[model samples]
Target: MATTVRRTSITLPAAHLGEENPLPALRTPADPHQVHERDRAGLPADMARQIGYAPLRSLLPVRRLDGYDRHRTPTDLDAIVIENDRLRATVLPGLGGRVYSLVHKSTGRELLYRNPVLQPADFGLAGAWFSGGIEWNIGATGHTTLCCAPVHAARVPAPDGGEMLRLWEWERLRDLPFQVDLWLPEDAEFLLVGVRIRNPHHRPAPVYWWSNTAVTESPDTRVIVPAEEAWHFGYQRSLRRVPVPRWQGADRTYPVRGERPADYFYEVPDSARKWIAALDGEGHGLVQTSTDQLRGRKLFLWGNGPASQRWQRWLTEPGTDGYIEIQAGLARTQLEHLRMEPVSELSWLEAYGPLSTDPDAAHGTDWTAARDAVARGLEAALPRSYVEEAYRAWLASADTEPREILAAGSGWGALEVLHGRFKLPGTPFDEATLGEEQRPWVELLHNGRLPTGSLDVPPGPTLVAAHWRELLETAQADALVEYHLGVAQWHAGDRAQAVRSWERSLKAAESCWVVRCLAVADAESGHPKRAAERYLRAFALAVESGQGDTVLGALAREAVPALLAAGRAEDAETMLGALAPGVRRRGRFRLLAAQVLLALGDVSGARGVFDAGFEVDDLAEGEETLSETWFAVAERLVAGSGPVTETVRSRARAQHPVPDAYAFQPE
Candidate 1:
């Protein structure tokens, strides 16, 4: 039996109705210092020789146009539609080529959440990340640096008589290539997403890939993963493996009631097939299925509270009506735990579609039963025999140790293997199992002394430094250790040493964190020009990689000041000019840009910037709105006020304080 796939192009309403989206362009600057290959002693030999240390010398910020493009108007955009008898998928080629929506023909219901408006929020490290649909994230952590950016997309001929939509982009930091192919077969219930990541360099690079699906969250929405236990961390000291659905007196399978948020990553049980689903009370839902290659399933909850609801509204227009993310990862955990070998190609296939339970059994237990019933439906769709064959093939292709550890169980043993490979020390295991001699180091590593983004336990910078040095003696190749060491030094006020440590960290593995720290060190140490360059590089990396909003916002806070101090007023203006008017008008960046305009003697320009800033809606609660400073500056800059003086500008700058460079650390 042959399956036929059809591809057609259609115009659909844009995400941001009656709004404007301006594209920003930036160029990679030439390195100033004549750094040689030998200068990069900390880097892998092959990679060091290939790129040398030239770009490391003087990194510059990206250049933006004089002002945002107001001439361009919003209109219905073209989308590539691929369909079969059972399912139809629509992809927006211009908007990161994300899966805009998937429709199940039998039910005529959306399998993926579709955003009514394209209202990008300050969520991604790259400045703006939109909600809804399935976003393919790759390269660096938090969301691939390109979540809200455009990628090269095309409709290609599939080898199996179906049409394939291919989207690809080259990651700037590591020069790696990533591609995703979406296709559907005739009479097939699911749409398959095939992803390929290739590392072209001669040395291994840190790589991560996840497909984040946004689905409607209702009071009855429940998440189901075929895992007996889950590991919970983030915003807490106790990170342990516990039973799924119900753990530590909290039922995590369903959303909780409160302002406090809950986020956890579950390692899928060793099975022939792995699946995760978000089911409604009616036993109807969306299910994601993949082979053993994709074993990590994560659930994120925003909780039912006033603050969470407000945040939801701020992130998307018309809101998602409330939504949750069911993300599937290729690695055992997050990106910090995974790496891609040089010149190697990694590929995997995942299916997403609608699933429903038997109508006769709907009135049984509760939402939990509905979830189980949906899981059963998925199991029947892909039989055990078929899953077993796929799992065996995947095991054959995977490396030896990871495969063995996964086979053993999903607990500390697998985590120990990954930690040993990455040279990270903390295992979160029972301390009773350790010998007396190794107990103190383990205690220091696992003790509650480690900072978990809390003010209660003031960070032990000195203690952290000592522990990292001890680990470095044994695990010299671990780049993350150097990163932590640099963080400790920066906190300890050894700015020069911190910069040196970050330089070594970059050689081992290039990350945006190291670059950002270097920028801070340069700024605080009185090298404003160098700091400007570094901040620009960090911003470029974030923009290139599609980082979350926190990182981008931090970079803006640091870069604008450094550029102004370096007397690069025009450059500062250009950078601010590139941002979406909405982004530029909010937060500290708006005030900072206005000060720069005033400093340059463009009083009218400064007034215009201030007026635009006032037009934006107030930021949501808990956000860094810097309202006091904005208001104070606004009072002084208003139309009838006297000419602004340097003192007034200085006072405004003091109000909006910059955060510590390492504030946006990867967990």
Candidate 2:
């Protein structure tokens, strides 16, 4: 059969992606994998500039997605499939346009690591990301906030006169629009993905894009890339160059040899083909090769340490085999953001398929031999010239309008386009897609003011880009107007103006949103005590009005932590006590309760939490809070009423090993 596209479903035990947390992400998720100041001591000028360019200070406009709990049901998720005669690719249109499965029809072999469940962890920039097949990471440094959100998907004409699946969305972080088109030609074994990132604005924008592919990993699996050295980044917060395949006295080619989670950004020479592959012991697995525009290749793996082992189980079912990540991006490292010029875009074509190479050469200790063997094999299957030709061919049909709409994304893109009068072709953000989130903003656009609403419920989603900021600034000052303007100003780096706007909004009406934002500003300004007080006030107001909604309960999660940080432990406990029974039972709040108990010197109460066994459903990839709290509880227990000093803490860590469930993150 020729290539075709159709809508389908994939059944899995999926944690319901609960409502977006009402709390604004005033701080980005802390990443120890990022480069440190010391890491820049010896870099070239261009590399240094790119690495340090446009790091995100906070995730404004976007809210944290921590409302999900440890609950899963057998659900039939919305999916789209692209099929050819030889291969079948399953995509999740409702959830980030992820390619969930790619199957080789003849061998019935799953080319990618098809995740058994749709379990979301706190991995993306805006939170709630899952581990699986192939995910396109766009926007800023971390995984895109759009990971759990929907994207506009449609059926478009392919380069080969066939239909292809196209996914597009407006990336809010850097205010750019991007599209990914998946195409399969007649009788072709390879899947071709054409990606385009556009800087529609007149000014330059920092861009980040990575096509991350997860493949089944084993001890004998060898990764082949065309590079002699790589820019290695570890959780140690350092980025330094090291020899490929044999770094730190281990054959880094094998995922099992890695001692800790790290990223190896291969320093591929300018003349080489851009590709990466992970072949099994017998030399058959997945290969990902992209055009020269997507020049960077990388390998990321969860190392074989105790922490890695625990994390492996946490991401999926326990005892399931782990997976390795081989990615292609526009920059040398995930830490760097490429600068896309005004009105210009970076486009590339990527191919994915099954590859079988000489097992002896691929698995050999000689890195050159192994990489060369795969490189030659890839050339035989699909050449660099052919990839370039395919990219040009796809570019020819890039402006072809969608034949049919498969799925709908957020209306933010439509809102932006309508406001800015942007003329983008091929990808249309139809006015029909606008929903409740954009209603007030839409009013502000046409009516010269936002519609006022009740102060009790959470305000509509905040729009913080420059264009939205201009509208909010001139709109008639009201509680909602000022509050949203403050968010926009904060996002624009005008802290003084943001604070003034918030203060003015509060003078008009009492709103939990404005107060919480003020509290965050206070905390960031080093007024911790005032921040804590404001946080409590915000939470109390939300509770009194929202009646313990899951969204409102999220503010409590922030308030208690703030109280404890301000050395008001007793206040933290009291705040926790006020929570409804159902709210307290949430895994996140249960964990917080333990911390509160510990702060109140109730060691036994804290210990009871662990004894009962609790799992934080959205525990992050590198987060070690579970183990930290466990040890703190252990230290208190070991001290026997004495003050738990450093020596006592050492004894606790030495004697009371954390149980498997909570044990993640290397010491």
Q: Give the alpha-carbon lDDT of every model.
A: 0.56, 0.87
471-508 per-residue lDDT for model 1 (tens digits): 54344434555665666555445657767877987887
Q: Which stretches of candidate 1 lie over 4 Å from their true place?
A: 1-74, 157-159, 234-242, 247-250, 256-258, 358-372, 384-521, 524-667
Span of 10 residues, lowest total lDDT, candidate 1: 401-410
- TM-score for every candidate vs. truth? 0.57, 0.98
Segments of candidate 2 deviating more than 4 angstroms: none
CA RMSD per model (angstroms) = 17.2, 1.3
